[model samples]
Target chain A: MTIVDPIIFNAFLNESKEAVESLEADLVKLESDLENKNLINSVFRSLHTIKGNASFLDLDNITTVAHEAETLLDEVRSGKRKINQTSIDLVYSVVDVLQEMLEDPEMAQAIKSVNVLKVEESKIEHIVSLVHELELLRYSMEKLPAQLEGERGDISEGLFNLELATSKASRITSELGAIVFGARLVPVNNVFRRFPRIVRELAKKLDKKIELKVLNGSAKLDKSIVEAIADPMTHLIRNAVDHGVESPENRQAKGKKQQGTITLNSFVDGNLVVIEIKDDGKGMDPDLILYQAAEKGIIFRGKENTMSDSEKLGLIFAPGFSTAEQVTDISGRGVGMDVVKSNINKLKGMVQIESTLGIGTTIQLRFPFSVVVASCLYVYIDEVCYAIPLSQMEESIHIAKGELFTQSPQRLKSGEEAMAVYSLQELLTGKFQIKQGIKELPAVRVRRKDGRLIALIVDEFSIMEEAVIHSVDSYISSIPGIQGGVIRRDGLVSIALSIDSLLETTFKKIPLAYAVNKERKHPEITDLQKLIEDAREITDGVLDFKLS
Target chain B: MRIYRRELFIFDIGGVPLALRMEDVEYILPASEITSVPKTAQFVLGLAAVRGKIMSVIDGGLRLRIQRQGTSYFVVCHVRGNTTAVLINRPLEAKNLSVKKIESSDVERILARHKLNPKMFSAAWEILKKKDSHWSETGRKFLEINTDQFVSDQMASKIIVG
Candidate 1:
């Protein structure tokens, strides 16, 4: 092993580890249907591959365990021995040893200590002989049924016609296609199952009376997408308990139930899967979030009053923005939500937060069915090509370059109230490189699900086509505005820009303060101020004290 | 004791002869159609697709701060399973040499002899600090490149600061 090339060893380790994990899963499934030939064959193949690779590498320990497991499975397959509970346990023991060896190969020399593999040869031979005798007896008994069927005569005349066969073949092919598609889909419960235990343990640890309710656990998503979302989902659940839910006494005083509830609901909406994590507790207060964002320099001071309630809620997803009064070991060093947002964006998903004061907060995440295939609108930014996922792009319009420089951009026909235009090249590279004296420019009017609209200026726009986007290395994907890259049919990779990341980063920066006249003209602010004053009078300055 | 003999793929970057252990070298191809990725470290030229894998091309001249002539080829090497391409002036030779592993304790002495700061060889220092046995071997004391450390160091120093 010391002589082995590290690269080859790593590749082998990865492949063998995956095979072993699948084998573990299949072995449990095999217990229910030990007689299923296809499943038994699959299990056999997994073990054989591991053994062969291990033997090639001269990994004596892994090879020995896998080979022993393979020999036992061969006995079951050959009908020399039956796959009873005892034999299944034997195979499981082998898998356990193999797993330990894979995690630390240096433990291989201790393989001699694995006493289960040293089963007595005479005991195994006796069981095989007993099973062989029973098989022979059963075969003799089954021959009587065949003799009875022989008297029924040939029924194959009209049953096997060309038309029927052709239709059956077509049906089988379609069924096979369905099976293949479904193979990539797994139930949402695969991830949801872990949450109940997590919530229970966390509730006990935090001394909070919180109940987690998971609805629609049977909803399905692509296996890859489901795996990708597991961490974010866990983070949200933790956040709900640690930060969202009020303590029991606090909840009682607030005229709520003593125990809080966190609900995880997943369902399919059109071509996308929607997963919502809703917590019934003290909701996210926009003003407090705004103050935190201001304090962190994520947003300019005094700009908090300018943003709407929903816009302030969006600030929680800004990097290093946390509303927790104190950092806890569990989830809130200010890095939680932004990471969740980025992971969701990497899945090409959208996140929407809806909260009411003292009511609750629900964070809704929507992901497309497949992360690999996407419909992207390809455009050229300074003659370099880039891709924007069509899910984020609402439309493309031809606008004068001067329009982009205006303080106020025209609203789109989609009826979004506020629209801002920015040069895509400037947003990406931090420098404007548009050629001198350019007049008309192509722009993409992109809107996130949360209803923030921005038009990005580009040199030219091209066709909107679905392309397979491959995720790049983290060194590149970790860049502020990049989601992944798409390998074009020409075998060149074009970067797929993340509209969510660009919007989020852009929104966090200081914006030019509104004109004095415009501030007075907006009625909403006056109404909100009046409401705040009314609340202040009713609460006798308590709200003022908290804000101060 | 058996002498560990390995092949070193020697190549030129900015007129300096450097060699990477041949086992890490995946391929060498003509440098063409390199797309520039914006907002990345200056050392990173861009991404190029070769055989369906996107490889980040690093400008060896910029990375090593060496003035170089025209880059003729991309020396593609694997760093922890990810392929990265480094521009080279030209192909030199593949030489088989006997390499002797230097202990971590001797690293400071070697750097002192070369009058190099530990920060200058920060990646090698990190490996030694971690007590990793896979040291950059001494084969005639010619600069033997550990592709993993070299590329990762470029990523850490250049990308993070930029």
Candidate 2:
């Protein structure tokens, strides 16, 4: 409703986690007392409650696995089958997958898809199969006829339970998925090893096997980032597998290997950690993309329809721009290429494609390893002061009143013909009341896009120490000009302002509030401003010199 | 529960000065100790380290826009519940003010002379306002600090932080 406030949601999620953990502990104890149907019922009830809570949160994937796990546990509780390892392990794996999926990459999509119900289906089947297998074995052992028996029936039942228990143990192991989740993981050389099994399974399903490879992984990505990159990487690889790699028959026909190959490589370079997904398959056809763009009305078909290949290729990032007519239900409609691009951008990274018609495609992605620390720049505009990241800043310059040229309502050109100036008032709405007699045009310019191309004009700029950033919940997340508020050195809160956003807010709203002598406001020493009148009177004879 | 206020420091503002309760002040450092934080609001002094942790030091005088005649000491006060710091000129003394009920009118009048918005003044300002003014509604002869606002929650309530 309100982006489901994370604080309360976090608390709720924590409670559910506790409930699941307690159930786990109880189930472990129940493992020994197979005939204790009462214990089985109690465990079933707890899992049922946890599943209900997850469903209420619309975490259906979790709900499904949990529901299935609960169903089989219900059978055990109903005395249809004795409690054993298979059932317990199924429940454990369900819980593990639920936890892992809670932080899964495909979660956002799954939340919207009907197939979200499918995640629990397999897990449920796994548990049911275990229960069914154990029941059959136990029933068969009991049916064993005469003499030769000895304690064979009992031993056979014990064997069935043990097999069931093995599965249960592994399911519990799957919960260790938590260990590799989101931010919790510290990947090593071995981390790359885990991907092959997944790739192989997926390849087998697609009826193709690619020699998947993992390159240098000496650098460890905080689990969350790794998780963040997972889906984007998956989409890219899937595209490479389906569209990039040719089938074995085709590959052989083309004088290439019958077994197509795709390589997944990752390493750290400069300030960025690079992840490149390359495949030796047919590359994307730029001409086809241009034709699709024209057909979709993304770009007008004009006399210049004979556009450069690069211009045509850029169409891949246009919204709703798709090259495929029928959705393959695979790596997007070639539609979400824009999404992949933008998502990587959100990570403060860039993605580029290097592909030729028959040659393989290489998608190179580079991201700032970790913005763990940022140099903050503090600026004051009228009464409101805010912080800017020095990481994005280039320089600050002072301008005289006459320096600003008003070309249009929302635009101010500062002698440099191209620079756009944003007034402080427009930056943060209702932040300060600019009235009579404030002097001096105090402004700072921050470099944007590239240092050479654009500059953002702001109220002021200077650098400060780095601190752990705490952002406000979404209720007040997008305050005009404010990116997030941070605790300052003096224990007073200073807002972290988005210079670009602030500028945009200014331009979008007024677009035409032309300034008159924009820089004439010099530092006015008023004897009576509400915030400082008392100190002024007491120090009537004192001289206040400015700090440089 | 006993609320231990941090160590207090004394400083002057104008010719008349006051002390800030130590619990509020995070650190006291030389003027030279302050570093420049770019693009910050004017009141911010810069960054400084107290004990081992680095913190932002604000110019309380600049924060309140308090004026003074000479070189001043920096008192970094932690904003309630937030890590932000507010810098103030040195406090003159640290004296505990007991809670008392008084008319808000008295505060308004007292602050009028200093050109302070009576809204921001402490109970101390109210007492001075009543004594200096002719208003009889200000009630009680002496002034009391709204303890909850002035100091800590262990005492009484009604002090507001905005």
Candidate 3:
């Protein structure tokens, strides 16, 4: 058979798969109401479409099975055959065969073989033998009734025990059903298995001896998350080999082993999957990154002087910013890092970089293991429900209304550290009015990724529960302080708050003094305000002093 | 000779009737709980889940320079591979309108009179003048908005407040 264009073929394959999935779901529903003509017609159409497409592509195996399935569905549609338990079983078997055909289309050629289809002669024989064995087991269980009669002869007790067992079995079956229908967990090795080959080839081409180690390869995560992270993870690994690991001669001169080591370590941390990539080679130079960013016009000239070392390191993620002296085919195109950042951000994940000038560089990528299910603490502000991810939450404290405005500077003191307090209502809806006659306000203390804590004052704290998180559109996700939307148990959509984004915005709004002296017991708020004005005047409002 | 009739989905936003090409509309849904997004343009009401997909909901009134008000329905429009919900005050009505193409001079006149950005509109459908009616002018037309361009403009105009 002539092969179709791969793009067209792939599209056909995806569409066919979706159709089959929908057909299966509809079939399950049809088991309850088999006389529903609409569903029967829908199922028939799906099979007919598949058969036609397969024939158009000249795939005889798939076309044959789909044709047979369509014929069987036609009988039911025409009311020639009544729907029954046996017919439902037969339809399920057809679905199984279709699923197998999807996996390997050539398998459809074995339709004539009873053992191959597993639904013909051999299947009946197997069922008959199982039934014979079950009869014997039932005969043995008949002694239990006699034993019960000899012991107490209480029929009510026996019935109660049976009822208890039935209830337990029902609960277990429901739990199993939930696990089967909910989000799937896939092994991390699905993405990691391709790395060793990549590292080997890149190391050979670069003429550097390198060792790649993968830890926790058996860790499983949601399939969608795993697929999303595959490309970004590959990009990070390539960067590790191309830009991070130095030449063997240079490594030796730097008092490092000739064979450099790159380790990919992943582990579950609470609700997050932390993947760390560490390379024992020449680390990055912060000053070089800053200079390169300036040269590329990614950052303003002289602005590099104001950036901290860590902030300078972050410039590598800027678009078209590269520290490499020359461009190569593998990397240094100044395109890969920004894409890595954006792709990870699309997964609602965060990436952080830590490096020592000469020791090594460790890049950490953190993602929520299951993007669908997350533990969220719901809080109500101005009668609006907002959910905060439990992973980012620190604790909730009730603050008296009088203490909120009684301090010289409006700040929340937790231990010896003071943080600038902001109202959640004001930040979200742009409404600054607190509820009238409210005495004690509930404040949620949230910690940023950088370990900075901020107290978000709200009206009250609601219940905490595990919820399925639904992501918002890209346009809305781009807005600061709004992460996504989560449908609560009450069927209402609540805004999932990104505490990190909120704190970043809050930190930017506060004066530099309060931000820098957050650890101090008391920083003169008046002096801080004056300093901010002076700094603003000197910079002519062109400079923004921010924490890295 | 063949006559061509263009079908449009017409709805009212802030009391002004507007029409959009039927092909661009995915489906109309009842406006539900919209999660308010911060640091966005005033026209962006927030995000809403429509048919299991989260879409950014834009207030059609604010986009057309009308007073801001709550909308009861959302018109889901798919443009440039992005799905967005345009808030409307009432149910959308599908009408097959027999329209004539407007001349360039008339287009310019309409643009100048409404003070509308030239890029925001793509085509104009001329409605035949009817006697003893609200629109009795000879050159009455309803401008067709370029949804792709309008969405991009709204997103670009978002104020990034810290």
Q: Model 3 off-target regions past 4 Å?
A: A1-182, A185-281, A284-371, A401-420, A426-431, A511-548, B1-5, B67-71, B95-97, B103-119, B127-141, B152-162
Q: What fraction of native interface contacts is shared by candidate 2?
A: 0.00
Determine the C-alpha RMSD for candidate 2 after optimal superposition of all C-alphas.
Answer: 27.7
For model 1, how does the per-residue alpha-carbon lDDT over B1-162 read when each residue is reduced to its tens digit? 224566877777666555677898987877745667877778788887654555688776666665668766888897655678888788777657555544456666665654443442322211111126543533333345666554555455423210
Each prediction's number of clashing residue pairs: 0, 48, 0
- CAPRI docking class of candidate 2: incorrect
Structural similarity to truth (TM-score) of each candidate: 0.45, 0.31, 0.50
Write the number of the candidate with greater TM-score, choosing between 1 and 3: 3
Q: Per-residue lDDT of B1-162 in model 3, one digit per residue for the tens?
A: 122377887776655446788898887766766766666777778776555445678887677764535557888996555678888787546767666777789778866765656666667766544457533334436677656754665564442211
Clashing pairs in 1: none
lDDT of 3 by residue, A331-352 (tens): 7787888888888877767789
A1-548: candidate 1 lDDT, tens digit per residue: 54565556665675676677566656655665777878778878989999998888888888888988899889888998888768876876787787778878453333323321122364356446545655654554444444445543333532333333333333333333333444566667667755765675577688889877776666567777777888999999999999888889999999999999999887544334689899998998888888878888999887776789999999999999888889998889989899999999988788899998788999998865533445799998867899887765787876542232223324222333544556687778765444444455567877755776666778788778755454555577667677666666444568878776677778754321111111123222333234333554453222211110
Best-to-worst ranking by DockQ = 3, 1, 2
Q: lDDT, candidate 1, residue A297?
A: 96
Candidate 3 root-mean-square deviation in Å? 22.3
Choose 1 or 3, whichever is better by lDDT.
Answer: 1
Error of 2 at A268 (Å): 1.8
